[model samples]
Target: MEFLDLQLVHALKTDGRAPLRRIASVLGVSDQMVARRYARLRETAGLRVVGRLNPRPVGQTVWALRLQCVPSAALGLARALARREDTRWVKLAAGGTEVVCHLAVRGERERDALLMGRIPASRAVTSVTAHRLLRLFKGGPTGWDGIASVLTPEQRDALAPAYPPPDARAQPVRLTDLDHLLLTALARDGRTTHAALAAEARCHESTVRRRIAHLRGAGALFFVLDIDERSLGGPSATALWLSVRPARLAAAGAELARHPEVAYAAATTGRTNLLATVLCRDDEQLYDYLAERIGALPGVDTVETAPIVRTLKRTGSVARDHDPADGAPRR
Candidate 1:
């Protein structure tokens, strides 16, 4: 993907449902050109602009799972976890012998089936570390704001959602089967039109629009824009585990969110209360970020970094493990 495509991703991150013509106007390009680039990206980059439910207000939880196992079982386990609907991200780290996954915990029954029943029974798994996310200072669309500078202030404002504070309380919603159908369609393709969404959900277009607005208002749904990593400097990724005092976690998370280098960060359970992913050009730059920036933060007890050797899956999109610019999966 080119810089223009990256800017397009930034625009979409702000408003995934924005019309191509509107985005083109902001990017100062012909509407046709913008559409062509998006088509190419969808085909070549394997990008998915998907919808995700907000779990916090719904009595749900998010946890980061770290598994250290023999090298032989690493990829197999990572792929297996990625295939499950509960997992949001699965990464092969520690030079391919370790696996890190994000679990969106919905209820105790679901959690037990995953953490106790299914995981412990797997063979060759040496260890498991579960980090329950207590709070998320920045996630989803909020975490991608650093790239918004590509657009002018007016363009940015135009793309903002009419929905109130992104932090609005989310009451749990028991979606009907029809509601799931609509949301699933949006998750597969957020740009689907009202007509298409209505068809998918077997409902009227008016009903589709009304339900979508309700979901948004209840803070039950949000969309995520997954841009190609090659456009994001390089493929080098790291997961940081930080030990911060319980009282200072909120402040620490807020401070961490301001750093442009932070791709995602949240407060978690276990010895470390914070887990963050940083994207950099290379190891040297990553070291500089850790030493000069993270080291400078107050109340940071300890910081451990795990470079992501390969991402098995991210937000339901499969990333190429080698030669990402060519968009080929590693063999």
Candidate 2:
């Protein structure tokens, strides 16, 4: 990622729906260049740029779980957990000594069934620790900045022509009040039936179906995924930060993104400019991955890692209601 490319990513992160012309102007680049680079970034990075809804406003809860498992069984257990509709994120940590998974559920009963019942049944899991997210300080990786400087204008321009023109007619469908009500209901319980949602929203099932289809097409809704690491027999999960040459960032980041163990990867500001989060099933997995997978990438200068002790809050909701500075009531 060149420094200019990093700037482009930052512009998009600020607003995913920002127009190409606007992004180009902000980065002091031509619209065509911005269009091309963004398209390539999305394709090469496997990144989904879409509107993110506040989970709590829609009535959902997020939780984090830590599991201890035997090294050999780690992959299988992780794969099983990853298959669940309630699991969203899964990571292998500390050489397969731990596995971390994020889940969304409606009530205590469902949560218990997942944690105590299904997880315990996995032959690979030895133990499990679950934490309900109480609050969230921040989530999501930072946009590129350090890499923006390395990209040449022509190189950036080369990336622009790849993007297809935006289709104005294909914009996301508008939601009715009733649709909002139904979405709110389903957000709380992703497994809820259409009839149930319709009843709660005071609409017919057909209306619910059409509205849901519209929301799905617009990327407003998706299936929730859940996983149990204990069953998978993996070790711990860790977060990592890396610094790389601005010119080589795009190629490097794209390479890391392809690793199956990596959960999230993005370009960001700060000392360790390129932020990458990965999951390892065991110590060997982590070591091999770092020593081989990450180390082999071009332009990498330094790597720093920290194990996530716990998640106070996650994607589904805002934990704290007070203001950050004074702790005053949020109005």
Specify the highest-TM-score model's number: 1
Name the regions of candidate 2 deviating beyond 4 angstroms.
140-331
Which digits, one per residue and each the tens of the lDDT, describe model 2 over residues 1-331?
Answer: 4555566654544444346786677567788897788666555432234323333434456666667888878655765666565665565665656667778786778888988898888878888866555333223322222222343566345333222322212344455787667655664544466788777877789988787666655544543311222112343556776788989877887787666667656565545556665667667888998999989989999997757532222233222234365452211
What TM value does model 1 have? 0.92
Report the error of model 2 at residue 291, Å: 23
Q: Output the lDDT of residue 280, model 2.
A: 72
Which regions of candidate 1 are displaced past 4 Å? Answer: 145-148, 165-169, 318-331
**What would the per-residue lDDT of candidate 1 be over residues 101-195, giving only the tens digit for each residue?**
99887789999888898888888588888888877777787865444347777878977777743442555677878778887788778889999
Backbone clash numbers for all candidates listed: 0, 39
Against the hidden reference, what TM-scores do the models get?
0.92, 0.48
